[model samples]
Target chain A: MTTQPNLAMRNWNQRVGRTALYLVLILACVAYLVPLVVMVMTSLKTAGEVQPGTIFMWPENPSFDAWIKAWSQACIGLDCRGIRVGFWNSVMIWVPSLILSILAGAILGFALSRWQTRHAGLILGLVLFGAFIPLQVVIYPLIKMAANLGLYNSFAGIVVVHIIFGLPVLTLIFSNFYVGIPVELINAARVDGAGFFRIFFGILLPMSRNILIVALVLQGTGIWNDYIVGVSFGTPDIYPMTVKLQTLVGSQFGEKEYNVNMAATLLTSLPPLLLYLVSGRYFVRGITSGAVKG
Target chain B: MATIEIRNLTKQFGAVQVLKGIDLAIDDRDFTVLLGPSGCGKSTLLNIIAGLEHQTAGQIMVDGTDISPLPPDKRRLAMVFQSYALYPTMTVRKNIDFGLRVAGLPRAEIKERVRVTAELLQITDLLDRTPARLSGGQRQRVAIGRALARRASVYLFDEPLSNLDAKLRNDMRIEIRQLHEDLGATAVYVTHDQVEAMTLATRIALMNAGRIEQYAEPQDIYDRPETLFAASFIGSPKMNLIPGTIRLADGVPVFDTGSDRISLAHYPFRLAPEDGMPATLGVRPEDVAPDAQGIVARHRLNEPHGADTLAWFTYGETNLSARLEPVAARALGAQATLGFNLHKLSLFDPKTERRL
Candidate 1:
């Protein structure tokens, strides 16, 4: 048995360690939240109030003028209309890109993991290799190919680029998920006369809700935040919010409007941020689902 | 009903050979069991028959049609897995009719087949529940109902009852046997439990190390084991194999274990053995009894098994086990005389391990 004084000393050490851990955690949280707090306070300030030495101060007379200007009246190049055009473009690009990529990824993943085909290993190796290649390396060739198909500087071109880039990683995620399912279940389906498409639609698809949610959150965020692909493949008429936001912030000639820029930045990021907050629980669960045997 | 013929079925994984040329034939409506320990290729053989695994070099004929090239669904075979691989997302009713639906049967026909199968398996009430909501036994019944609804020509069971508790296993074993008899269906079951093999199989193929040692009726395999391995593998307390020598006394053969001699005058010899030949005597624990006119042995231990008792004895240096009645077990003594039932004695050649 431990002595009374020794046990008390050990308990004191544990208390000190726990307090130190909490102190570190609170400091880290404050450090991360500072920038976000500054953004909100700065966006609330009017043009005159948003000046130097007022970074952490509250807005003296808060108004929605900056927000309204960012939404409908800000200028990018020659257009006086604000980022609303880019917001609609981003939505149009993201929806088709998300759906087509997820459908293709899920089917390819199911086939690669379950079916015994002649070139399955080679196909899987190629897909894995494709996932590691940087998007910048293939951007020029994809542009040339899109131009040949009469799709460059168009809305379809951006959606197609996102789908192509999204396929490799999404397939890998879905393939890993499918591999966690027991092989006996697959065999039973085969014995039950369920062919390739039937097995996917009937059995495996219904059980893939968690992994599909994961794919949606990941791909939605990536495609929405993409600026290079959007600006490179799209014309000014079809530029997504990221590209339009860059033009709105960096193209000003005089008297830079910090509040308007901050408001536009916040507006550009709100959709994906809301998406993550809404399904954050499912996102964590999906990532950790197959890690442990249930 | 279908007859399965497996000719020279062999399987190899890289350099390791799992099955070395197995050949067997099953008659229509016969319940044939492949009984062996783990890694003995019994499950591999069942998979080969079920078309789940391809044999290295073999031919499998079902009802005289070579089905080696067909897929599992085309082979007219249904399998019940050990894990009861029920589709977890669907209701039990959908699980039973999945195969029928896949085969493109009409709606009314699929419903009727599902109803008949559920009634036969007595799982009618469980049809609406999903597999996740059912108990272990109920899940097993649904699995069986799934296969029964398909009404395939042959049913393959891969250690179906091994997952149940003791009492449940016994109950399921009887129910499976009764189902086989009622439907007159051919079944090829694989199991390691000898009691399951003994109680359920019409014929037991005793296997060891990727080869069948003996294939015969259960009682024949138990009473007249053709090899030493078969003799030791089939008994509960295990057959006591006492090494001895056959000595000719006045031209009549007698087995001499160091401490005692037993006359083999009434022993049916497949072939007459030479004098002074080394042999091993195999006698089951149940065949040895306590008697006054017999060889004496020191009583070492008594194990009470509810209805009967097993007494261990030492004769010279060789240990023996005798199954005794409750009354005989009550008469405790330091030493006792034991008699070997001569009709049940098995003589094996020591070198070849084969019966002599």
Candidate 2:
């Protein structure tokens, strides 16, 4: 009929609209990628070539010397060692802190969401409210508490500080996710002779893979990029990579080496970047799915 | 199997009372169904028995053991949920064996039990597939298999077939009845459907507004309902109730409808009606017939069901229905005479609404 021609005309108009939309999206992607491209190119340039005017230009003689110097020979405070000096210390602090904090958050979340304890609503509200308070407001009190416990400027002190800050957001994420699961599943498990820990570990935990990955990537990035906590709580020799990198770049009364600073910054960001690259699919899916109730 | 007794069980949510002093007893291997409409506290009572919810004030005795203080995991029971709450991430095999695995049974024994349950449910091919891959019926079968693998003494079902389609629901109904017969487990099921209560329950506890109206066999409930609510709630087209006064004519009790008088000498009453007392007469549709020597009435409508035809007519100011043969129903015109089977009629006291 004559309606077929009208349908064809509408289809043509839709095609034009789609093309224009894709063109705009491509432009936006390029705008976001420019700063990352500049960082990589600046890291490759030699020390003398990294002048203020040529920051975004391609390196004239691209070499690995700046990377080698940033990794090994750059001076930071009294230590002449590069950002590599704090690499193992960061790993030590990050691994234990990540594991302990995630476990505590998950258990607390499961208990708060599933159990019928008195004042559970109050407890969850307090935790969510604690997430909004800035860390700088409580840093002095936290330092005083750590000193009273005789754990100030130590590895344990830094690990505890990371856990205290991470608990609020991690617990909020996990509790919100667990609240969406069906109550019948928990009842069925209880009727199957599963106790509290058994139901948590055997049934609920296995089905929480997506949310677990989301929590891991979030906590990994947050702990990896942390600088204030490390500088305040860590001794000179036990500084995490972020603290060491900051001191390396912000050295006063010394020649500023822009290439080494750029290289070290890139190196410090690689772990979290790799984490996102490897598990980006689950991150987006987890966040969107966890937002809505099943 | 175990005998279960619930003594004066009551539950309250804030100020609203959901279950008000319920008492029930299930014999060994009895399929007792708690039947009621939604918000009637049938499912709430079932949850209390399964230890999922604690009763506000009551004692639940399982084989002479009071389980009031115990957690749900300590109670040796299994439940089939309406949602078929199989673990989504696990395969059917793992789902069936999850209880056994948590109970610390040996691996070989757990595997054998799961195999036997799968074969019994005819889901062997689906053992490796996750719950997401199975259809609704298949997931329900896996849930039942999970409960069966536990071998618990008491099994609770909370409207398990409500999620299935109509055809699948009927098929699963028969399947569940057969499963109960084969296993001979003491089962307590909950449903709001009267047909399900009639077909599947050995004893049906009819509940309304957080109270049990009647607890009897299905035939007893249909033929001799104890209360007015039970009488109206159990039938398909509903029992017709006509209000009148009981008076004496020549020393014989008669129902006077102010338009016509009917003799009640052949009607069996639990207590004889006094003269000059208000009464209501109840008759099923099947008990009325079209006859030559009967009350003359004008036909209003004819509803042709598959098995029979229901003809509606006015008697006095009350409309009444009669179940007639399809062929006979087709022959009816605008006017017909209706006969009531007087011996099968029920008489109720208007004040108490109880059988007289």
Individual DockQ of the candidates? 0.61, 0.80
Q: Candidate 1 i-RMS (Å)?
A: 1.1
Best by DockQ: 2
Lowest summed lDDT window (length 10), candidate 1 chain B: B70-79
For candidate 1, lDDT tens digit of each residue in B101-167? 9999999999999999999989999899999999888888898888888888799899988888998
The clash numbers for all candidates, in the given order, read: 0, 0
lDDT for each residue of candidate 2 in B7-106, tens digit (9 for 90 to 100):
9999999998999999888899999999988999999999988888989998999998999899898897989999999999889999999989888999
TM-score of chain B of each: 0.97, 0.94
On TM-score, the leading prediction is 2
For candidate 1, give the lDDT of residue A283: 88
> Candidate 2 on A1-294: residue-level lDDT in tens?
999999999999999999999999999999988878887888899888986658878999899888889899988887878889887789878998898888778878888897655787889899889899899999999999999998888888999988888998988888888899888999998988898888888888998888988999999999999988988877888899998888888888567888888898888889999999999999988888887752
Clashing pairs in 1: none
Tens digits of per-residue lDDT for model 1, A41-124: 888899988767579898988887898899999998888899888999999999999999898899988888876666877887
